[model samples]
Target: MEPLLLGAVIVAAGGFAFLNGFHDVSNSVAAAVRTRALAPTVAVLLAALFALLGALLGTSLAVFFVGAARGLPPGTNGLAILLTAVVAASGWNVLTWYRGTPSSSTHALLGGIVGAGIASRLTSGPAMEGAPEGFLLRLILPLLLAPVIAYLLAYLAVFPATWLLRHASPARVNRGNRMAQAVLTGVFALGQGLQDGQRTTAVILLALIGTGSADGVGIPMWVQVFAALLLAAGSLFGGWRITHTLGHRLVHIDPMRGSTAQGVGSAMLLVSGIVLHLPLSGTQVMASAIVGAGANQPFASVRRPRVVRVLLVWLGTVPATALLGAVLFLALSPLLQS
Candidate 1:
C-alpha cells in the first residue's frame, strides 16, 4: 500500500467512525428519551461516555474483524481493499441516515469486505484471496439469526415483565420502568461502543499493517483510544432522525416498553458480539426488539408498514453495500494499481 493511499484510507476510516458514532446514538439511548426517563442531552452524553468506555474495555472484536480482513486474497492490494470497503460502508451509512433508516454499520463493512474481496480476485489474478469458508459461515449465519434472536428475546422479556407488573398500579409500573430505562440505556450505550467501536479499530489496524506502519497483528492502545474517542465525538450530534423513527414512529413507546426494548437489544448485542463473537448490528437488533416490545403491548399491531420498511432496509444493507463496494473497486482499479 502506498503512503498516500494508506493515509487516504485512514481518513476514510476515521470518517466512518465519526458517522458510526452519530448513526448509532439512537440505537443506544433512544429508549431512555422515548420513555422520558432521560433528557436527550443527558442520554447522548451518557451514551458518549459509555461508548468510549466500551471501546477501551475490549479488543477481541477488533481482533476478530482484523482477522476477517486477512481473509481476503493474500496478495491483493490491502490499501485498495480497505479504501473500497470504507468508501462503500460510509456511502451506505450516509444514504441510510439521510433516509432516516437505522441500517447496520457492521453489515456495511462486511458487505464491502466481501465485495472488494471478490473484485480483487477478479482483477489481481491469483494473488488476491477469497474469504475463508469458516469465517464466512460464522459471519453470515449469526447475522442472519440476530434479528430473530432480538425479537424473541425482547418479546419474552416484555411479555413476562408486563405480566409481572399486572397487579401494580399504572403509575407504579411507569415509575419502575423509568428507573430501569436509565440503567439499561447506559448499558446499551456501553455495549454499542464495545461492539461497534472495535469495527472502526479493525479498519484502522488494517490500514496500519497494510501500509507498513505497524510491525505485527497487535493493535496499539492508542488505536483503541482513538477509535473510542472518535466514536464518542460522533455521538455528540446528528442522530435525531433515527431517534424519532425508533422512539415515536415505530410504536407509541411507554416507559416499560422503552426500557424493555432497549434491555433486550442490549442483551442481544452482549451475547452475540461479546459472548458468541458475532459482529451483529445494534440498529437491526433494536429495530426488531422495538417490534417485539410493541407486540407485547395490549392490542398494538406493531405498525406493520414501519416494520416492513425497517425490515426491508435491514435486508438490503449487505447487498447494497456489496454492490457499491464492487463498483467502487472496479472504478478505482487504475488508481489502485498505481
Candidate 2:
C-alpha cells in the first residue's frame, strides 16, 4: 500500500472515532446533567478525561474487533474497504445525531463492513469471509440481546435503589443521588472510551497490516494514544441534540432513577466489552436503560412517540449504513483500485 493511502485510512478511522465519542460518549453525561448531578460543562470535562483513560487502558476489545477484519481484501483493496466502512459509519452517526435519535455506532460499522465486503466481492470477486455466520453469532446476537438485558437490568435496579432510600426524606435522597450520579456518569464515560476507542485502533491496525507495516499480533502504542486522544477530543465537543432526546424527551426521572439507569448502563458496557469482548452500542444500551427505569416508576412515564421514533431509527441503522457503504464502495472503486 502507498503511504498516502495508508494515511487516508488512518485519517478516516480517526474521524470515525471522533464522531463515535461525539455522538455516543457525550450521552453518558446526559442523565447526570439532566438530574442536576453535575454541571453541563463539568460533566463533559469529566467524560473527556475518563474516556481517555479507558481508551489507553483497554486492549481486549481492540483484539476482538481485529478478528472481524481478517476477511478484507488484501493490500490497497483492503484499505479502501476499511476506509469506506469508517466513512459509512461516520456519516450515519452524524445523521442520527443531527436528527436527535439514538442509534448504534457498533451496528453501523458492522453493517458497513458487510456491505462494502459484499460490494467488493460482486465487482471484484472477494468478500468478507464468514461474514453472515460470524455476524450472526458474534456481533448481531450480542447487540440484539444487550438492549433487552440492559432494559431488564435497569428496571430491576430501580426497585433496589428506591427501596434503600425509602426511609430518607426527599431532599436528602435527591442530594445524595446527585452526588452518586456524578460519579456514575464518570464511570459511564470511562466504559464508553474503553469500548469505542478500540474500534479506531482496530481500523488503524488493519491499515498497517494491509501495508505490511506491522504484524497483527498486538495494537501499537501510538495508535492507541492517537485513538484515545481523538475520542476524548470529540467528547469535549459533545452532542447536545441527542443528549436532549435522551435526558428530556425520551423519559423523565429523578436523580435516583437517573443514577440507576446510568449505573446499569455502565455495568453493561464494562462486562460486555471487557469480560465478554463483545461489541455493544453505548447509545442503545443507555437509552434502553433510561426507558426501562423510567417506565417502572409510578411517577415517571415514557414518551411513547419519542420512544417509537428512536426505536425505528435504531432498527434502521444497520441496513441503512450497509446500503450506504455499498454505494460508497462502488462510487469510489475506480480510485480505490488505481
- Cα lDDT, all candidates: 0.82, 0.87
User: For residues 1-338, could you state the per-residue lDDT of candidate 2 as single tens digits?
Assistant: 46877898899999998898898865688899889899989999999999999899778888777776677766766887888889999999999999988888888998888888878887764666664566458867888988899889999999988889989999999999899899988899888889889989999998898888988997889999999999999999999998898999988988988989999999988988778888887888899999999988877489999999988888898899889989988987888666
lDDT per residue for candidate 1 within 1-338, as digits (tens), equals 37777778778888888899989899977778877898999889989998888888788888887776675432237677788988999999889888888889989998887787778667863334556888778877877888898888887888788789989999999999999888888899888888988998888887787656875458898888888888989998848889888887787778888788888888877776678877878888888888777787668656788878988988898899888888888887777666
> Clashes in candidate 2: how many?
0
| Candidate that scores best on TM-score | 2
- TM-score per prediction, in order, is 0.94, 0.96
lDDT for predicted candidate 2 compared with the true structure: 0.87
Which 10 successive residues of model 2 have the least lDDT summed?
Answer: 127-136
Query: What RMSD does each model have against the real structure?
Result: 1.8, 1.5
